[model samples]
Target: MYPTLRVRVSRIEQLAAGIKSFTLQPCDGGALPAFDSGSHIVVHMDQGRMRNAYSLTSALDDRSRYQISVRLEEASRGGSRFMHEQLRENDELDIGAPANLFGLGDGAGKHVLVAGGIGITPFMTHIQALARQQASFELHYCFRNRDSAAYLDELPSTLAPDQLHLYESDTGGKLDIDALVASQPAGAHIYVCGPQALNDAVVAAARAAGWAAGRVHFEQFRNEVDATGGAFEVALRKSGVTLQVGADEPLLRAIEKAGVKIDCMCREGICGTCETAIIEGEADHRDQYLSDAEKAAQKTMMVCVSRCKGKRLVLDL
Candidate 1:
């Protein structure tokens, strides 16, 4: 288990129709751990049964409190719903320390950010920090409409004129990803955070435009993985145990039920914390953390979201 911080909900404000901003302060009234602009913290809800990561939207310099915005997910697995419905101001919760899987390019000549809907949260702090350093950047934010755009009004104030661009689907504003990728100057880095479809499109566009894989950074807000696959068997080499993984159950959950402990943060497979070695068998990799090359190698797999390709897998557990 990751270290947790006891925090009190200082404030909660409706940012949009289904989005709310939460202000969390240290319960002991001390400075919270510092984090980078694009960092996120996992909030443990439902007595730690449900964990969800929310991007930090607050200023990076402020250690007194951390602000995160949660969009009430329509198909929520209880995390977003709990934050919106059950959680209230003055409520106390345990949240993991900040972990950054997304951050600004160290020395890129220009930074291009593409955000879709609630995906604009991380860029909120990114743009602020960039503006403070007088960095060259552009934020292209897209949403269904003004009513659904979280912190739309506040973004313009943070970015300079022409640095912020808006695209509303209701207004027939479509972002031409290929054109956007082609328009970027040399040495520019592209960062995207949005739905899986949007993230895939950006990656395809970048690759087609001859951008190096490292130059294109993307973060998926959520992945709709079908966990109900064919059942398989996992052999724990070190423990000398073999466990049956149910068709409807994830591999990681099965390991835990068998009394095998695995340190995992995001069970969604994006964090790579539950990644374990694969001594034998090919993996039906479903995680976004592993690269195509790594998946093809099949030396290891993220058990949280991946499964064995064959009926049995030998793992160096």
Candidate 2:
């Protein structure tokens, strides 16, 4: 369970051309919730529960503040625009308690970290943790140009030469995904956070290099599911209710209309917050969070992006 707290934006700085970073602190001047590395808080921005989950970029030891970077995307759904334009310093806003889907690998002494664009947010925690522990680690950040990449100046100054590498496409610097994975030791763990293409490429390269499944970690920040998907009927077993979900409406929204509230962190289905047991129907799973084995099992489905394969479906809700 996550508690909602009101926090004031202490500072807001433009990190890049399109990105703005905000520093938030508790309104009451009390200690904020303690969080592990790679945690995020859900910011509910509207009456319809329009929320955006942002990675906490501040260090874990910094209990006085929490930082989040927002990119003003051209195709944003108003969340980024709201933060970039309407939100200001000294304004109080509601944010959820920190929750981590990506935790540091303590058992592995050697770590390889990869980031693309804003995916660098969560890795700040990982880098700090590894540096504090004096563990062996390397980070590769891929971006189109320096102006577009957030934390461009900050990371290089903080990290040593052997710790960080920046690959700027504008400078003709390319990342050899295949070679990078092959160079890592067998005991090393590889973690990546990026767009679909980058994430897929890294995972594929690592697997081809014989990296075990357990040794590879990733957190996809984008949800590429098509919103104009076909809809169907859903049956709630415990509630004894059935609702008709329109083709244009997401399954999660349909369920919410029927008075079933499922706590959702990232509505994009990447966080696995809305996974529900499938009582007796096939689901067209469109989420990136589920593993191959989980998808093959067909026991659960992520309602945020997934839909029914047939006319009717039963859920353990």
Candidate 3:
């Protein structure tokens, strides 16, 4: 289990027109735990009623403070809006320890980073690490416009001019996925984080360009929407309880409503914090955290958003 710490915002800065970065300091005035590039924290808010995930935008060597950038999402579930508009310096927030599914390769020859919009948060740390080590890398950033791009002024100075590529859709220029994939050197490791469309484009382009599967890595920044809300019954064998999940309700909410406890971070199905074992039944896994083999096995499910295919599911809750 991850340790939860209460942190206070010591400073806040507007990175872009709609983006704000908050520097958090430990309330106990102690050194924060060490974290690597691409690590993230789960923030508890609304009196623990909601938990949201945010990528760390600060350097790993800076243990005294950690920073996270937030973009005002219009259709947000109150977390981003509260962080951007309501939260003030000196306010306290419950934060989880750093957890990372994205990290630099241990022995990769070349690093190719592709970022879009707010996805640049994790790439910031990667770029800092690469710069310090003088690693061979390139960063391709895609945004809707320059005004909405975070750390625009700070990034260019950190990365080499030739290694950085920026694209703005509103400016009639988009990320040239074909050119990027074609330009990648042999045995190059590709890392991409962005919207679903951008991710799909990169994956498709890379595959079409004959890039190996193991050479490509991606992290999604959006939730998996459930279009076919199928009703199902979940049986918690360990607890000797069962619950009926409505078509619109998620398995996590239904189980929690029955007094069962399950830890979750990003309820959008991106984080794997709420993963549980399935003893029986076919799980319609919708999360992006699981590997292709894991999804094919159907032994585990992300209760936050995944559902059962049949009428009943036996879970080892």
Q: Which candidate is the best by TM-score?
A: 2
Every model's Cα RMSD, please? 2.8, 2.7, 3.3
TM-score of each: 0.88, 0.88, 0.86
Across 116-189, the per-residue lDDT of candidate 1 in tens digits comes to 99899999889878888898999999899999889877877877779888999999999999999999998999
TM-score, model 1 to reference: 0.88
Global lDDT scores for all candidate models: 0.87, 0.84, 0.85
For 209-278, candidate 3 gives per-residue lDDT tens digits of: 8888888888787532451378988899999998988887768768877888888766667768888999
Off by over 4 Å in 1: 223-235, 239-250, 253-265, 280-284, 291-299, 307-314
Ranking by lDDT: 1, 3, 2
Clashing pairs in model 1, backbone N/Cα/C closer than 3 A: none
Which residue pairs does candidate 2 place in steric collision?
none
**What's the distance in Å from true for residue 70, model 2?**
1.2
Candidate 3 Cα misplacement greater than 4 A, ranges: 223-233, 241-250, 253-267, 271-274, 279-285, 289-299, 307-313
Number of clashes recorded per candidate: 0, 0, 0
Query: For this target, which candidate reaches the highest lDDT against the unseen true structure?
Result: 1
Estimate the TM-score for candidate 3.
0.86
